[model samples]
Target: MNKRLFLSVFFLCGLILSSNAQEALFGGQNITSPEVHEDGSVTFRLFAPEADVVQVTGDFLPSVKIETQMGPMDGPGKADLTKDDKGVWSFKSEPLPSELYGYSFIIDGFKTTDPNNPFLIRDVASVTNIFIVGNGQADLYRTQDVPHGTVTRRWYDSPGLGMDRRITIYTPPGYETSKDDYPVLYLLHGAGGDEEAWISLGRTAQILDNLIAEKKVKPMIVVMPNGNVIQDAAPGEGNKGYYKPQFMVPKTMDGTYEGAFEDIIKFVESNYQVKANKENRAIAGLSMGGYHSLHISRYYPNTFDYVGLFSAAIMAREDATGKVYSDFDQTLKTQMDNGYKLYWIAIGKTDFLYDANKEYRSKLDSMGMEYNYVESEGGHIWRNWRVYLTQFTPMLFQ
Candidate 1:
């Protein structure tokens, strides 16, 4: 062989060797790392003793592979995750607050949760996992007398989405007591989630119970709707394209969606003995549901007076624009024509949509639209959305 060809072969061999070495480092050390404290710095470690790759997954890091300590993905955010010599794979977490967050390991594109922590929020149809941080004083969780809310499993047919879906409605203390028509707040779940989400995982009902019993919030009815326009059997698996999700906001839903949202409202109004009108009704949601509230409120301007977007999936750069504002104007127009009130937006300081919500708020400012915006401690997880609803409800229907 010629000299050049021989050198090329050698280079190829070297590359294969390097890749093999990295793969060897990544075996069975699950990608998830545990919280460690050392003076001030936090340390994280993963233990995947029988796997080929492991990388930490969370909202903080959208991408992967920041370093190459173990394998191609061994150092930091690597897919070819690495483990210690004794099947112990771990790393120190960045300085973080005592608030809750979600994380997992992507063995390929699939996600896996931590085995050590028992406290977790299950995802839609019980498919995935999210980590809940103990409220600083871990023992307080055991001793605190937190009043728990009641979650009732209910089903409603959504004419807007063209399907039948289940939802969880959380009624506070006085719901079953009297013939009072309490204000209603319609809560929407995120993409790849279902009606059981907020109740089973988000814990909206429990928070309300604790708050209302303490007189922290006014008594009201919380209506959680399944956001997807189409029905989902579970996460990652569905009817494919035969159905649509409610979160998908088009230029308009004139011919699309089959008015699934309206059906939801109608069903609730007819069935539940609750005040049903712009003044007595509100809509709010997280991620995709945030998008739903904005669009749904716009579409059903006569229906909802108060609108809340919790860590809305819409981006300032992507959603804050003329068309969006124009649609918002139309929604506000209906409310203004009818003397409606309350438009609130909230997101976590560490949330991905933090900056986006600010920009959206700025847009709302430019349009002379009145809205309430808030920033709390968290990221794009249910923990933040839960508190956001808890804080925003007391101020509603006043």
Candidate 2:
């Protein structure tokens, strides 16, 4: 063979071999990085020949320290990965409880989603890979064979805020065909959450669907409204059709969110064929949303007959402002006198807001009010929130 031809052939062969070697690192044909076993143990795999080190961080593991607005918050713990001669890193986790978990790969100190897993959840500003283990609580988060509801990213006029806003709405299976009017659940999200938080992270639709299918709860419409006072919608959704400049503002500059609550109620009542009375209306929220639910209920006692606060950040009237609001006690007494179908409060024992929840419960006790209290295991995480929703929805509209 000619000398030049021989050199060209050698270079082409080397390139092909390198390509094949790269492909082999991903386990050739079998691409199951997270192989969940029958016993609920999970094995994770990654192919990073050039990486110096790799680790897995998830809720199933111990708390991994991550920076947050409130200084540094401990996220799920980290598990070191062992590398093999094939340039593949792997780790097998202990049997995790049956529930949905969010995890990410820490490749050389930087957080990244699993390249092998396509199931990812977007939370606040970051994204993480997710996996489910066994049945039980995990089954509630999964999409079952029961009737499903329709979730819509809808726009509504917010005259109070002077801008059109977006909200997530869930209409049950027969909402369109049947002429029957349904009760409405105005569900709110946490401080950093948007309208999509509940449907994506909380699994509101699945919980309601399963409960309604089992006849444990009546069919109802769930409205997830954006509670941010300034931002009209979630990130990347505004007048520009993308993230607007004011999206990251410290707080809503227009007005207080409590004052704007009526806009949402009016929109739902006017648009949907829902029972437009206090008896058929319910309001619930988590974290910051819990605070909103508390204030909204107090501000307009005649608007909601059912109120739920999950991991609520309830504050004493003095703690809320410099002094107590004059009408606060009267409003509470009036609401109790009018009679509420259900005033439920649920919180995890380890939650950061647990103490505050206790304080609020004490106040309720002093007022001689009737409310249901639920204390579960775990902290202020999505797992408890999902469980609270499952427990709360079933007790509604009875």
Candidate 3:
């Protein structure tokens, strides 16, 4: 081969290697970074140069459309990020409130999380990223030295997804002091999230500690689980359309794990010296986890007493029209109305589920089910859910 041809071949190989290296570094999809401004808002940026279209999705952004605000971060529309000469993609938005935000990047029709953000909470245990905006993070995680809970990672044998999976747990202090029945809060993860979401990204253990120490909330054991059906990443994931994954439910819910709920419940019950009653047992989560919380508690009503669904998709109507779970039949009605100590739901005013929440509440009114509902000012991000947990947990065991 001629020298020029040899040089060209060498360059092509280097390009391939470089491209592969980039994929490894950025996890092959989108890049995200946050800018905390002087204003109350925290501007968010996601980089996806190779991606045709990159839009930001999180609790702060609404569900109706990607280019606009749906929930709390109402202003600073959801516009596309501009590309620079470097072929590096960049999109910027206005500031967000101080809290942990759950965001994912969509590139060439695929979902990706930020590689830059230090706050990568999983979809299950600690499933969101943390940005200490001007609001609650410092007080919640920094200054507040509440009693620290025990965070443990565990594995489960699964035949449904056909693999071994990981899970994490959070046990309150003094849990070892009592073998008596105490409630357990089974926390679930969101999509593209894992067993580490709650403790790491959400900073839930610290928040719970501070809240418990101050007598603001009751001390309870928190359990985090992986919500995804498949144990590993899907094939051809880089650029895919359709949210078909939304339709699948974990087999644990269907009794595939042979005491799946109890496996966790028993694992938690045996591992930690805590309570084992309906009143002492609670379950909750966000997004996929939120749906998990709603379904698990309903499906296994005998297991948990308190159920928390944050910006969750419990109502069937929400699946069709972005509405909340409101209407219920008679047997379902009796169960919901007389279910537990607290059948709770908290969400953002600016979330796509806002109307759904309202509709669900109205239906609750019709059924005379007095569920405890709290509404905050924000979108569907972890910031809202983290703060929601901080405020919501105290109500338990009270």
Q: Please provide TM-scores, in order, for all candidate models, with all chains considered together.
A: 0.65, 0.87, 0.62
Error of model 2, residue 201, in angstroms: 0.7
Candidate closest to the true structure, highest TM-score: 2
Count of clashing residue pairs in every prediction: 30, 5, 48
**What would you estimate as the lDDT of candidate 1?**
0.62
Output the worst ten-in-a-row residue range by lDDT, candidate 1: 67-76
Q: Quick one: ranking by TM-score, best first?
A: 2, 1, 3
Tens-digit lDDT track of model 1 for 1-398:
99999999999999999888866665423344455443222344556577666666664333333332212221113324457898766655555544444566665466676665444665632333343345452121221365544567666666545566666677766566568787788888776666767765666666666667667677788888655544533333344543333323342223233145777778778877788667888888887778777776766667878888988855323443433345556665666465558888888776656777887787777767788878786566665776686677778887
The C-alpha lDDT values of all candidates are 0.62, 0.83, 0.63
Compared with the true structure, what per-residue lDDT tens digits does model 3 show for residues 138-193? 46765354556677777755544456556777777776665555566777765445
- Model 2: per-residue Cα lDDT over 1-398, one tens digit each: 99999999999999999989977664453457788998899999988889999999889987655665644544688899999998889999988899999989999999998878878877777788988885788887878898888898889998978999999999998888889999999999887788889999998898888888888889999999988867778878765456433223454212267778899999999999899999899999998788878878877878899999999877643424411233777878887888889999999876778888998889889999999999997777898888889888888888
Taking every candidate in turn, the Cα RMSD to the unseen true structure, in Å, is 13.7, 5.2, 9.0
Off by over 4 Å in 3: 1-97, 100-130, 134-138, 143-146, 157-164, 174-181, 232-260, 316-331, 337-339
Model 3 — TM-score against the truth?
0.62
Q: What is the lDDT of residue 182 in candidate 1?
A: 79
